[model samples]
Target: MSISNTTNFTNPSDFILLGIPGLETAHVWISIPFCAMYAIALLGNSAILFIVKKEPSLHEPMYYFLCMLAVTDLVLSTSVVPKALSIFWFNSRQIDFSACLTQMFFLHCFSVVEYGIFVAMAFDRYVAICHPLRHSTVLTNLVVAKIGLAVMLRSGVLVLPCVLLAQQWPYCRTNVIPHSYCEHMAVVNLACADTRASSYYGLSLIILVTAMDMVLIAVSYTQILRVIYSLPTKDARLKTFETCGSHIAVILIFYIPALFSFFTHRFGRNVPLHIHILMANVNLLVPPMLNPIIYGVRTRQIRDRLLRLITHRDT
Candidate 1:
């Protein structure tokens, strides 16, 4: 998805997704776990939304950010998994050029938005732990609304250009994408025109915004940890550390696979194609699936409510 200096442009063809490339034969089997992961993601995130709405005491900045994360995760997973399952389970591979661009947009958009939620959640922890006295005054409903709006706007603004560029690229080269979804790089590789613009746009957006958010998150957590350890009693320190541990776990789950997939896509020439693709899929699917589970297990409020709901079969 890129540009050409010439006035000539050829209409793009409908792209054929080759679902896992060499592993096409096993796509049916692959669909099983993918379907399970999607199901779990749907159920887990929906439960987080449900439990938060039901418990009055859970109304706070942290849970508000958790709700944003849950909703973003739901969008992130749903954007790709079902279509991927169509490719895997039923041999449905033809995606219209417009649809391909659309998928590329939303998938990348919400994926980045999901990372933004992580940052917001991190900041929530920083405030709650480091400045406990002013947490409410600082992250009030209006400020939370602003932060959520900022995350959505930042993601939408940054991602829209790439999808637009994808549409301009002349797609006379080939239409078969050798992966499960319409990844930015995969789509760019299909353009007959020079694609340096698309590549640079994508890399710049990822490096600038993602790297900035990560650095801010790291700084916030560093401040949080410093405050946690300074508590006069060991019990105080342990309890505080336990609260932030799950957030740290969520961070690791989000970034590790994402960075690896990106690295393999650009520099891992020696790596197998399917492995890279699998890593990309993991970057999208695993975080959404695990974020809720991690929060439910770690946050006492969510955990208690979830357990009670399960035990009582609450309406």
Candidate 2:
């Protein structure tokens, strides 16, 4: 909570990103795992995109939404990690105000979009499982495309006000952001102006968006479970559950870390600053790194296609 003099508030040109301040000495070592995760995320998600595009059998709504998720994970990681690694490996810690705002915008936008995709996927599963006869008509390719576009536009529109709000503030305080990335609230806290509106807006959206999506997902799954139990055999029940395993795993990975990080940042009085910073970074990193692996392992089509693709390349 370092505050600077108000006299320096004359529209500062750039802000300094204090990347993991407590671990500055070990930043290079830290960059090793971070870079590795980024690389794996990039490669893994790319493989998903490629396989889904090449396989005509995967031209369904579920895989299309999965492809959207992969793209989001790719962009989300790219938004946060390169700059973080730069701070770690090259000591490139300074970012222009505009650049920081842009980073924050994309970081939050893609994140919102990612959650939207999860909701879309959950809806896809609900339709597929609970209404198998009408699933095709209900979630046609055109409908899926529209849903994907809507998710993108919805997130883009919602997250814009956040960055625009940041732009209005005068950064008279120490331009040093305590976290690795330029999150909206972190940047807002540096402003000399009243930030009640921005703070309220950000928190309200998080609660609203996350709660709405979680509630819808819960309803979808509840209906799905009711449908599953009506099946005549245990094998049929297990098979039905297997189809949802990847989505469940991904939802847990995505929401649990994100919600925990959000809570700790906003309310964890006893939590250390470094822990907050680390969770912020973790929320950004882990899902992208693990999502493709989860899908590849749990979803038979993706696993088979990936293995065949690799085997063909090897041969």
Candidate 3:
């Protein structure tokens, strides 16, 4: 075959995922835990939704924000894990260009939405603690609905250009993506054409959306702490901290690994490629798996409802 003909086979219409480097012999073994995590995430988030729906008391702004978070986690997890499972169990790693782009879009869209939701939740906590009297007036259902809608729209609009630009580019190079699922930059780097615009856009999107949201969340918590410290008693301080425990756990779970993975990809050139890929997958998986658990355990309302749910179901 000619060199051009040889290149054609490597540049397939569908891309194959490198499930995990240095562990090809153990893909099935690796898949078991991932499968469990995905199952738990799905069930746990669904239960959160169900409990929030069935319990009329949970119809308030806090649960409303949580419901949004649960939905975002569900979408985000579903977008990636199924494909990863396929790659692991069935060795079916070929993903069409359109399918890959679709996955990338949802993965990023929900990710951004979830970040926005975190900021929304931070604001919810802020109002609940700092301005308790006006919390109801400020975060009416209409307002929460508007916030939810705005977050979703903002994520969708911001991520669309990345997809459009990617679609316009011709992938003349090898189509093997070095991660188990379609990630934004991994796929972007595969394009043989000039990708400076896409690179800049992705970086800017991360900064504008995720980084900005993190800063806002931090500021919200700072104000919340100030309010808590101003309270007269140690009991008051403890109560305030207790109220924020679940959100704090979730914020740490969601951001720490994500930011680490982001920085690794950008600056950790000495880091192993597999480490980068593993952390990326972990960042996606850990939050969904842990969020429901954290909320169920730490948030009294959710824990009480969950216990009541289990007891009633058993009876």
Q: Rate the local accuracy (lDDT) of all candidates.
A: 0.87, 0.90, 0.88
Model 3 residue pairs with clashes: none
In candidate 3 the C-alpha lDDT for residue 61 amounts to 97
Model 2 scores a C-alpha lDDT of 0.90
Candidate 2: residue pairs that collide? none
The full ranking of all candidates by lDDT, starting with the best, is: 2, 3, 1
**Model 2 off-target regions past 4 Å?**
1-7
lDDT of 3 by residue, 13-70 (tens): 6777878877778889888888899899999999999999999988999999999999
Model 3 accuracy (lDDT, Cα): 0.88
Stretches > 4 Å off in candidate 1: 1-9
Q: Is candidate 1 or 3 superior in lDDT?
A: 3
TM-score of each: 0.95, 0.97, 0.95
Q: Is candidate 1 or candidate 2 better by lDDT?
A: 2
Q: After superposing candidate 3, which stretches have Cα over 4 Å from the reference?
A: 1-12
- The CA lDDT at 278 in model 1 is 80
Compose the digit string of candidate 1's lDDT tens values, residues 1-315. 322233333775477888898888888988888899989999999999999999999989889989998998898888889889999878888888889888998899988887898899889889889888999999999999999999999999999999999888877756778889999999898788889999999988888877898999999989988998889999999999898888889889988888888868988999999888888887788888999999999999999988898889755
